[model samples]
Target: MKIKLKIWRQRDSRSKGEFKEYHLDDVSKDMSFLEMLDTLNIKLIKQGDLPVEFDHDCREGICGQCGVMINGIAHGPLKNTTTCQLHMRSFNDGDTIHVEPFKAAAFPIVRDLKVNRSAFDNIISSGGYVSVDTGQAPEANSIPVTFEEAESAFDAAACIGCGACVASCKNSSAALFTSAKISHLARLPQGDKETSTRVVNMVNQMEEEGFGYCTNTEACQVECPENISVLNIARMNYEYNKAKVLAKK
Candidate 1:
């Protein structure tokens, strides 16, 4: 099937970017979205044109590095799907797809479809972990967790930190991602000691990184490949407010 793509092109974060159109006459319906891009790159290279640059690792859709806005939607129109997992068949022949990097003040475009997502790393580093002394691994049964708690924590932990939430949000908020990280550890007993500090630091770091506030649009979970719940955001808020109040006391 033929496809028309208008992809964003930029040299670096400091440079201006614009959509460059290309036509593919031999796109296979079976080809994954990244595979379709590979075909386009192959064609461009053969024509002495520089290939479009996009980031992808673990095309199995676990990496979350392959996100791109398609037709104004983060990770395309599919719900709970990543760009790498989206197949060409989802698009019809002669469809004009607009592809661009995730847009946010915190996610500056590195080049083309690649954006510097280090802000996510910064948020994680700020307080996404439980600090403990180095020693032999603790026994698994030492701290027994109920099935419900374990399941809920796992659900929040499923977030791959794709920045799709930030991209899909009207305010370019990182609340969903931030909350997922916070909620994941908060639900576990091992993370209890640092929960208050973790929430405060991570939430502060999110604002420091320039991510906008979440307005409860719930767009983040819709585009999140993992379908991480917005309830995590509520948990984060509760934890954050409780921390601030306790700190004052």
Candidate 2:
């Protein structure tokens, strides 16, 4: 099938970006979205044109490095699917698809479909660590954790920090991502000692990094690829407020 793509092109963060259209023929419905891009890039390279720059470490979609806005939706139209996992079969023949970088104040455009997501690293560094030393590995039963909490923490930890939540939000918020990180640790025993400090510092850092406030739009979870629950955000809020109130006392 034939497909048309309107891809955002920019040389750098300081440059103005625009959608550049390309028509592709003989597109296979079985091709992954990134694979489709690869075909386009190969075509451009053969034409002596610079290939479009996009980031992807693991093509299996676990790295969270390949995220692009497709048809104005973060990670495309498919729910809980990463860009690397989206297949051309999802679109009809001769359809026009718009692909662009994730847009958020914290995630400045790098080039083409790549954006600078280093702000997420800064936010994690702010308070995403536990100072406690568990030393060597312990026996399986040494620390007993309930099935519910363990599963919840595992789910929360599935977040790859893809920033789709920020791009999909009207406010460009990172609350979902931040909350997942906070809850992943907070649910575990090792992170209990630093719970108050972790929430306060991470929240402060999120704001400082220019991520917007979450108004419960929930576009984040819908596009999250990992299906990370927005309940984590509520947990983050609870942890933050509880920390503040106790700090006052």
Candidate 3:
């Protein structure tokens, strides 16, 4: 199969970005999206041209490091699919694919398809901690947690911090990401000690990061590669309110 790619290229965050088109031929439908890019880069390197730069680590969809806007959809048209896991077969022959990085003020473009997503790192650092109480392994089952509670926490923990939620949101909101981070900890017994403080600090940090507010548009949920529920946002709000009421400033 052959396809036309209109990819965004930018030298840095301060520079202007625009689409540069290139034609790819003899692409195998079996090839993963990144691999197809590898083929393109190989040709570019042979000609001494710069290759398209994109983020990818582990390439298996577990690590949220890889993401891009494909044809105006986050992670392509597949629900809960990351760019690295996107297969060329998902596209038809002679199709024109628009490839671009996640566009949000908090996520600044570094170069060709890569964006600096360290804003997420800062948010996680603001909270998402268990104070390492002795580092000694506690006996499993010391605390009685229902199976439902455990599963809910695990589901929230499924978030990989891909920033797709922000990328897909019209307002560039980080509520889904923040909520997942908050909910997973709120659900776990280990996270109970600082739950109130955690919610407040993380939410504050999210706002400071220049992220927009969630208006329940549900775009984040539709594009999240993990299929992390937007209900997590509601959970986050509850936690924040409870923290404001109960937690000591």
Local accuracy of candidate 2 as per-residue lDDT tens digits, 87-150: 9999999999999899988999989999999999999999888785578876878778899989
Off by over 4 Å in 2: none
lDDT of 1 by residue, 1-249 (tens): 999999999999999999999999999999999999999999999999999999899999898788999999999989999999999989999999999999999999998999999999999999999898989999989999999999999999999988999999999999999999999999999987799999999999999999999899998998999999999999999999999988955
What do the candidate models score in CA lDDT, each in turn? Answer: 0.95, 0.92, 0.92
Candidate 3: Cα lDDT at 199: 91
What's the lDDT for candidate 2? 0.92
What would the per-residue lDDT of candidate 3 be over residues 86-204, giving only the tens digit for each residue? 99999999999999999999999999899998889999999977777597888888988889999999999999999899999999999999999899988988887778889999999
lDDT of model 1 at position 158: 94
Better by TM-score, candidate 2 or 1 = 1
- TM-score for each model: 0.98, 0.97, 0.97
Worst 10 residues of 1 by lDDT: 240-249
Q: Candidate 1: lDDT over CA atoms? A: 0.95
